[model samples]
Structures are given as C-alpha cells and as structure tokens.
Target: MAVHSSDYPFSAFPSPLTTSPKVPNPESQTPSPAAAAAAAHGGSAKKRKSGLIECQEPQGGGNSAGESSLDLISWLPDEVLGTVISLLPTKDGARTQAVSRRWRPLWRAAPLNLGASSDLTDQDQKRLVFVSKILSDHPGPARRFSLPCMRLRDRYAKINGWLRSQTLTGLEEIQFGYEIEDPLLHYPLPPSALRFAPTLRIAYFGYCDFPREMAPLLKFPCLKQLNLCGVIVLEDVLHSLLCGCPVLESLLLEGNVGVGCLRINSPTLRSIGISVSCYGTRVENPILLQDLIIEDAPCLERLLPLYPIRGPLTIRVVRAPKLEISGWLSDSITKLHIGTTVFQKMIALSLTTSMRSTVKVLALDTFGPNLDSVVDFLKCFPCLQKLYIKADLQKSRKNKWSYNPLDPIECLESHLRQVVVMKYWGMRPDVDFAKFFVLNAKVLKKMVFGCINNCNDNWMANQHRRLQLDNKASQGVEFKFRRGSCSISLTHSRHKQDDPFDSHIFADDA
Candidate 1:
C-alpha cells in the first residue's frame, strides 16, 4: 500500500527523491546545465531531501549572489522568466527568490505550486512545519497543490489550514488520498477540499469515500478531468458527481471501485477509463466495478478498460456516437453491446448498429489467438480502418482459421487499411491465424508482425513460406516484421503524455 513515484498522477512533481526540473541555458538545452545542477545541488534539509535548489542561494540572502556576475537567465522577459521559475520544484522555485533582486519579486508574482510527500521527512510534523512556512510566505493565485499521502483522521486540521491558505485562491489542480490507518476514512469528506472547486480543472482522490448527501452542494464548472482511483461511493453519488461536473471531459474509475454499476449520462464527457487493479493485497472479498452502461454520452469518443479485471464487467453501450477505441477491447469485457448488436463470448449474435462507421481504429487484447472473435468484431465494426491485435503466444485451437471467400468482410474488402499484430510467436496456430489475413484482406495496405523471437535469414525465409506471402490478396501490401512485444502502459501522467490510452507508450522492448 506504499506510494511510489509511479503512484502519483504527475510523476514530475512532489517526489521526495526527484531533482529540480532541468532549466535550459537560454537557446538550447545541453548536458552541461543538468551536470552543473547535480554537482552544486545543496539546500535546506527539506530542499535537499527533494533534491532541489540548483539556484542554491542561502535561504533569504541576495547580498552573496554569484548569479549577479553572469545573469543570462534574468535577461528574459518578466513573463517568460516567471513562468520558467513557476514550473520548478517548490524548494527550487522558492530558492530562485534569493538569486538576485530581479528574481526575488518574480517568484512571489508567479503562480505558486506546493507539493509534499509522505517520505519528505520521517514525521509528518516536521513536513507540516515546513509547509506552514511556505503558506505564510507565498501571496496568492496558486497553480497546483499536491497533498502528500497522510492519515486524514489525524491531519484533517492541518490540511484544513493548508487549504485555507490565502495563496491557493485560484488553485487549478489538487490531489490527496487517505492513509489506510484512518479509522473514519470515509465519513465527513473534508469540507475544505472543495474550497476552490469552481477554479479546479483536474482532481485526483484516492482511498476516500464520497458522501451522497453532499453531492447537491457540489459544482465544478471548470473541471475537465476527474480521477477517483481507489474509492467507495454509492451508485447515485457517482452519477451525482458527474452531474455536478457539467463540463468534465475525462473520467477514470480505477482500482477495485466499490460501485454496483456506472451509468454515464453526460453531454460533454469525452473519454472514460475503468480498471479493477488488486496488484498487491489480501482482501478476502474486494468490491469490483460491475456493469458500465452509457445511458447517454453523445460526445463520448473512447471507452477504455485500462487494467484487465479478473471478474465479469458487462459494458452496454446504449449511446456513444463518436467512440473510437484502439487496443482496449477484448475478452475482459463479459458482454459488449454496440448499438443494437450484441457481442457475447466472442460471437456476434446480431449486427444492427447504425453507427458502424464510428469505430475507425480498434486495438484488441485477446487472451490468446481468438480469430473468430476478431472476425465477429469486424462484422460489428465494418468501417474500421486500423486494427491492432495483441494476442497471447499460447497454442490456439487445432482447427485452421476459416473464413469463406464468397462471404466477404466489409472492412477487409474495402475499409481496413492497416493491420498490426504484437506477440506473434510463429507456431502452427500463429501461421494459420496470420495467413488468413494475408490471403483475404483485399484492401489491406500494411501488415506488421511484432514477433516475440528474433529471426535470422533462414528463419525469416521459413516463416515467409508458412504465411505464403507470394500469393497474398493485396498486390500493394507492405509486410514488415520486428522483434519483441508491446502492451499499453496505463500509468497516468498529465504533463508528459496527455492521453493514457494512446499507443505512444508501446516500444520494441515494452
């Protein structure tokens, strides 16, 4: 249950072990600045713990400014320089004030960011004392604040004081979680938590319980993204929270959510990611997210199941007119309902969705080589253009993948343009599975096989013979092969990668 750098949504900030963000040398970044900062890193015990203060001036003294001699960074426009300092770590950002008279006012004028980690010190008392000092020093209009993981039951008063700081009036993002030791972890959701809700754009809460009674009192007009990673809230409270965030675009309900079902009815919601992750635990019977019904989400584009859940989770899509998913769909879903069509147990019982053109890009995580399901899905999504399949390397059914030439798939014949398969171990079933596409897909332009094992000249020739590439259906098809496998890493990072579900995370060695 311990928190690591990865646990934090924005891994760049608030890490006790992290160094100050690398500041550039005016024109372009060289390796020199980072090395210099590393060599000269020194500050208060708190700042030293966070590995900050490259500007490393004494706490509040500017008379000894070595920076006064070579002042290239200070030449930047006040607006530009202030922004640069604002993005630095709290200790580093605060340290810049001591560099020179030019830098002193800049730190106070720039929007503030305050971050504390549980590991910042051996005791929360010492960390709170340092945080209290920063609160009293900074003036106003804070940008983001991340409250370190702590037991809310004991430190709620301290958190209240921090939230009540005059500096955080225009706060944009805030994150907090309750320590498992809190006996009253769920009840009386901190009243000061929503002090700047109107201005908040992103909120991440963990291990807390939402009170349905207080839902009517909430309104987050500017909230765009809300992530309640590990929490327990009643079904109505969940819907009520969505109602309050009238403009929320991205919603993630991850980590063994204790809700009977999640029914979304939002006009502005764009994407939803759900996962039941019990990576390390000994809960006798943990609650899991059950049914996900899109009662009405006209603007919704993507429905992502980020982590593979062990239990059944039915997804009934009543209305998601613009949904375009890539690689987040597979057998993990107990049942899938796209419009009027029903896809259960990898069989298409009906093909009645009028929004057949909605799914242009799809990525499927087949537990194993389940070709029939892929074919069935093609029937459901006939207008798909890009298809990415990550299948298990285990031996599939002995029967060959059979699809009638007389009965054509719409996407394979006319629409489907690219096909990429990851973890392609060239066993007997793997050959049968891939050769079918090579022999049939008439409009397929590219076929990429990400093989698990490395191949030599002789091995490549043997596999080429098995797939019968010489007699392929598409004359202009470009086939490629590469070693290693890939799967999407669902870890959230607001700064580096905006979309958690994108294929940007996949690489040769991943």
Candidate 2:
C-alpha cells in the first residue's frame, strides 16, 4: 500500500526540474531591498526569491501590497506533482489544468483514479457529460474506475460508449453499481471492455447482466477477486466465467438467480461467499440448489452462506486439509447448527486424537432439551475458555436441567473464564443455567446477562438479586448486564492469529 513518487514518473519530463534559482554568495553581492526586508522580518534572504514568501513590501512604501509571486509548487518534480494531483478529487484534479501549462500534462500522465456519482450534482446529464469528457481527453489506461450509487438507466448507452473507448489493459480495479431506482432492472455490460482487460485484479458489478454469447471468450487471467451482486446471468454463463478465471482467490455472489448449484474447482481459491434468493412463493420449488462442491483448493480457508439453506443444501470439501484448523476442530467456528448425527461425529473425532483441541470459543443458538448432550460436546475441547448461550425463551421455558450436580464438567471447573447468557428473561431454566456456571466455574472471571426482550429495570434487578444469592466458586468473577443480544465472535481474543475465513462471514451473514 506504500506509494512512492519514484513509482509514478512523468513521461514528458525525463529529468528532474526545480523552480528555485541558484543563490549568489552572501559576502560577494549586495542584498536586494526584498532580501533586506526579509532579513529585518526574521526570514532568510534566499527564502524570498524561492517563492517561499507570500508577499513583498510595496516598492515605494505604498499602502497596497504587491500581488503574490508565482507558486513554487509548479516547479516541483513531475513525480511529486503527479502524486499530489492523484490525491485530489476528479473534478478538482481536472481544474488544476488551468493553474499552469506544466500542470496540464501532469493530470493526464498521473495514474487515473476516476470516481463519479450522479448524486454529487443536481443535473445528471451534466455529470454524465463531464465524465465522458474526462474519459475522452485521457486515452491512457486507468488504475481504478468507480461509478457507484448512480442512476444509469437512461444513460446506459452513454456508459457503454465511454467504456468502449477506454484502453483497459493496465486497469487494476473497476466498480460499477446502479442506484436504488429500480430493483429488478439489469444494465448490460460492454463485452468488448471486459474481454480486453487482461490486468484487472478486482471487479464488482451491481444490478448488471453478463453477455451470454461472450461467456466462452471471457478470460481475466489476473483477476483475484470478483463480486457479482444483484446480477442476472445464466447457469452455464456463470460457470464459464468462473472457469476462465484461473487464479481467482475470492468470489462473492449475493441475490443472484438462474444458478441453482455452484461447483467450484479452483486450486488457488481461498474464500467464497454466497447468498441466494428463493424464486417463488411456494416452498416446494425453493431454489432447487443441490450442492456447493469445492475441490482441489488446498489454500481454501473461508466458506460462508448468507442465509440458512431451506432445501437440500450440501457443502462438500475435497483435498482441503486446512479447511479445519486442526483435525476436525475449527478455530473460526463461531456459530454451529448441529444435529444428533453431527454431534456424535464431533465426539468421535475429539476422542481419536489429543492434538485436535481447537474449539476455544463456542456460541450455541439453543441448548436443546438434553443438558447432558451439551455437556458431552464441551468435554471434547480441552482448551475451552469462553461460552455464549443464545437461549430461545420458548424452548428453554419447557426444558429442564438434567445434569448430575455431583460430577462437574472439567472446563467449568478449570478452563472456562467468561460466560454470556443472551435473551435472558429470568425464566426458571435460564436462572438455573446462570446459577450453575456461577457456583461451579472456579476460573470464571466475567459473566454477562444480555436482556433482549420482555425485561425491564425491575425484572433485571430481581434477577440480579437472585443470582447473587448463590456463592460463586471464583471470588473475582465480575457480573455485567447489557440491553442488547449477543453476537458470535468470528475471531476471539484467545486466538489473535489471522484467520482468512473471518472476512467471508460478513458477506454470508448479510
């Protein structure tokens, strides 16, 4: 991310240039009146001629001061000037052309990062014309071009025309998204523009449609990230586009239809995010997505599905040993929806090896009817520290604690330190669960009760009073109460190491 002036050189200026004139020896030459004044004013004489001074004394002691001298910034090296102009906004950078003739070529020669929106100005047509003019005037390849959150329905042809004229061989990133005018409309992308851009590394398109006819020829050999949000394309066309990207590392698809199933077979892919919208009102049809098959992705780390799959949704991972952090344990498993079969498998996996203790933090949606099943699951992870219980009030109201008080869980007595019980309404089961941890967890340092519904000040006070009556095993346990629900931590404080899978969860959770 570091930017250096040497990286962006001016093609027209081959040598370094400066505006400051060489200074004469102070002892040999008599100081000018301006230099004398500067010396009297506590400024160096050479700083006056270098355009560092803002104003000079009137020639004959007149009342008015003389106009400011030429800016020394114009004399800066082309590389420095290019870096300065590149930081300016598109409109402000264009206006710098009027500053001087030297500045005119600097804007064109600098790496072009054009970003415009219709919301910036009242007249949409004028904005479009201004963007078109900039694109026409600058024929070089751009570094980044972004036109996000703009209304492009009427100006689709104009946008396509502007894109067609661009030489995007060196373009690194491009983002185009339509405004919230019409939700279902899909703007067609220029096929020629995409086909010619061989150096594109990141591309994001919203409310757009891909050309089916050019799917076979679509190839972005250097593309590492591709995001298609609210885009419409055929199943085969989507597959063909994915097949063409040989080294893609991240792929995100949200609200995309016409593709029932996705099969990713990339060797370099590391992250994937998918969110699908059901087709119709009938639950039977339910977007018949069969399986998301991932194969040969040894570096794969993150897999996220935004919504819960309603139909037969299966995820099959092949040849990805790193998918699980250690053995069958995953350090990034924040939220899990486990059934009886999967729960049994976890138990078997934990017992097979002593090195597979990766589940340090766990969040449960519901404790289920059997408390022993939950206790048995926790016994597998010997390094368990923090526990989150998102209690379903209705199910918890009917369930009862079935664990024997004589035998305490190993984690509760030794490893467990922090506990959070969310959606607490002082129900009998909820109070019992909270009391169990307070009384048994010898190492517990913090316990939080998050009240999300049906609990007011008096209710919280009463619950707090009841919980304090039980003598806690850990003398330093501090209790806290908040007004919101608990959120699953994708990365916990215990595990500060970077997890590649953490970035893909937001796309899936959204």
Candidate 3:
C-alpha cells in the first residue's frame, strides 16, 4: 500500500549500513590466542558483554539481543506503524499485547484500521469487551481508532461518552464506519474534545452531515488537504469553509450537491481539481478565480472542464501566457465548428489586411470548403506547426470538395509538419485528399487517417494497403500516411447530428 524506506533497520544506523554487513577484517598479523579462543566459543562470547558500557569500549554498545530486536521492526515508521497494526486481524493484534509493554499501549491507543469483515460477532464482542476494558484501564490518547462495518448504534451513547472523556489528545486519524437504520442523533463536540487535538490532520465524512459551524468545530487553520465527495452542503457554504481553511492547499470536489461558480482565493492554494455534470441549465457565473490561479503557473497546470458547454461560452483570457489546449476542444466554440464559415470571415478580414496572427492552433472537423480562402487567412500565422482536421467525404448539398490543395496550405509546407484527420471513414474522396496531402506536403512527416468502427475491416485493410504502397514508393515524397482506429465515430445508425451553428463559428469569440 504505502511505500516504506528500503534501508529498514539499517536506516537507524549511522555511517555503516547495509542489507548484508561485510565480515570483520582478519585480526592483526600476530593474532592474540585469546581472540582465537573467543571466536571458538561464539554462543557464550556475546553473553559476557551486557548493560550500559562507556562510549570508547569495543563491545560496549553493540548487543546481539538489541540489534536483533531493532532489525525486526526496521522499516516501521511511527506514521505507518498504526496502519500495519490496523490491517492485522483483531485476534492477531490483541495477541501481540503480551509480546512487549511498548506494544501493549499502542495496540490499544493507535487508531485501529479494522477490515471490512471486522464487525463484532457474538464471541468477538466478548473478546472486544475484555480488550476494551484492558485498554480503558490504561489511559492516554489513541493515535488511531478505526472500526469498519460496525453496527454500534446500541452502544453509541456509551461509545460517544467514552470518546469524549478520553479526548484523543494526539489522534492523527480516526476511521469509523456505522451502518444504522436511522440517522444518528446530532452530537455537539465539546470544546475540550476539539482543543485537545493538536496533531489531527485528516478526517473523512461519509454519509455524515456537518453542523452549520463545522468550520469552527474543525481546527481549519491546521488542515492542508480537504476532500469533499458525496457530501451535502448549502450553496456557497463549501466555498466559505474553504476560505476559512487558510493553510488548505489541495481541494477535490466530486458529486457535490450545490453546484455553481466555485469562488476560491487562498494564497496557500496551489492545486485544485473539480469534475461536475454540466448538462443542466448553465450557471450565470460558474467560477471567478483570481490571484491564486493566473496565466503563469507551471505548478497549477491542469484545467479540467468536466461539464459540457451548455450555452454560448466566452473565455476572456486577460493574459494567460502559458495556457494551451491539449484535449478535446469544445464543440460549442462557434469558430472551430464552423469550418467554412470561419474561412469566409477570415477571407473578409484578409481583404482588409486587418486580421491578427494571435490564434496559433486551428483544428477543423471538416476541411472541405474555402480551403484557399482559409489559407489566405492563416497566412498571418508565421509560426504555425500543427493543423488538425476532419473532412466529410460525402458531397454536400452545395457542391463536391471545392477546396483546392494548391492554393492556401501549399505555402505552409515549411510551417506545418503534421496534419491529423479525425473521423476518417474509408471513402474514395478522403483517400484522394490523402493522396493530395502526401504529394504536396514538403515538410510533412505524418498524415494520420483513422477508421470509424472495428467492424470496418475493409476500411482498415484498404488503409493498410495504402500505407504499404506509400511506404514502398520511388518518385513520391517521403511523408508517412499512418492509418489506425477512428478518433471519434459519427456512424450512429441514425441521422447525423447537426449543430445549431453552421461551420466557421469562432469559439474564442463565443
């Protein structure tokens, strides 16, 4: 589960440490007869040296018994020792109490991580009672107290009273699961209970509701990580709670009830990850994050928009210097979806010579119409390298493939090296276009065409054949036309889904 240090007991040592120690060097040239005799009586020699010896004494601090004891528990850190004990079956952990006095205290006080099947059975209840009695008699804060699948409602009052009185002063973790029919009665935590906890770091609230003042009840100032999944909170309540958690750096929200623009601003905050269903009516102002996450943060790198774009979305990026789109560009971006329409707009802009070269990557679902016109528009991008496109081979109502290969992108041979074609249903028109790209692209390294379905065996076969022919050619250019599975399939066995906006919809302007 948790990776521990490999050095083990050797980690406790200074200077000399190894999994296997080297044998001591041979004695001086003139070996003492006493040293030879000492080697012979191996079993009896070690017992002669015992108790605290001075620092300079040769055999003083090194004892076989102490070394053996330390070696057994070498890898066990104080942090994970509780985990190892919790993972043990109840009987096994309890049996360890007699081994040593040091174990007896931790076995009782450490937060127990009982397995899923560790609920109290009839005999187990008796044993647990005896164990609990023994632990209660010897008192201190338990580092951990874990019980899972426990039907402890009948003893809730008693357990709660004991927990309150005990006041786990040093408890770092407390994992307890209860399966009760009705919701447990709300119990207010005493001031002493909250104040006593100095090292309490993490807590999981599953199927549990926090009081209105859960922020104060929890010493929010000390927490660095907070995970809220499947928890109920009023609108803006979570945001308020997080604002109070000054030291909180990481926040994960999954399947939360109240969903809206999550406003978060904390200097200590470095990473944030959120996924929510955005199929419903769009919120007016979903999120307004500032200072904490700006344009230039190599640390805060991921922007996961889990929800679908519900309405006309416009991201007014003031100055996101390092922002780059990696996966699945939004379909609702009007300019990206309106392939030919965007070309027409660009054509118009090119006429006035006013179009800026700010846009870098231009990915088209269909590169059918106005190729010449769009190329005229993209002439502004002097540093363009990648051109991603998906073309519809079927003849549209207006005309066949009207885009000529020689006019626009022909000049971009030096700038564009890779052209990715999505939804490549093996059609003659698409193949013919692929042939044109293979012939014209001077700096092209790869032309990736993807098949739509697994059952499209014929398409895959033809693609393979085309790839082979290109690979073994003599006069043709040295560009690769790699074919594989389809990136996205549109063969729904029904009518093709048409977007409300035609091609050439400017996404950034949305």
What's the candidate order when arranged by decreasing TM-score?
A: 1, 2, 3
| Tens-digit per-residue lDDT, 192-292, candidate 2 | 44744478898887766667898887788999988887666778888999999988987877666567767778888876666556533323343444456
Among residues 3 or more apart in sequence or in different chains, the pairs in candidate 2 whose N, CA or C atoms overlap within 3 Å are: 306-508
**Residue by residue across 1-510, what tens digits does model 1's lDDT show?**
344433322223321211223332222232222233333332323343332245543333333344422343443446655666566666556556544555567777888877666433446666667677667877867888887466565666777788888889989998877667634334334767777889999998777666667777788999999988666666777777788998999887777445767788999988777776552342435566778889999898777776554423688889888876633676777787878888775567787764667878777777556777788788788888888788775664552666677987888889888887878888887777788889989988988787777867777999899999999989999888877665554554521233343453234332
Superior candidate under TM-score, 2 versus 3: 2
Per-candidate local distance difference test: 0.68, 0.56, 0.39
* Candidates' RMSD to native: 8.7, 12.4, 15.2
Local lDDT at 256 for model 3:
43
lDDT score for residue 253 of model 3 = 52
- Residue 354 shift from truth in candidate 1, angstroms: 5.1
Off by over 4 Å in 1: 1-77, 118-126, 151-153, 179-189, 277-286, 310-312, 393-406, 494-510
Checking candidate 1 for backbone clashes, the offending pairs are 327-363
Model 1: weakest 10-residue lDDT segment is 9-18
TM for candidate 3 is: 0.44
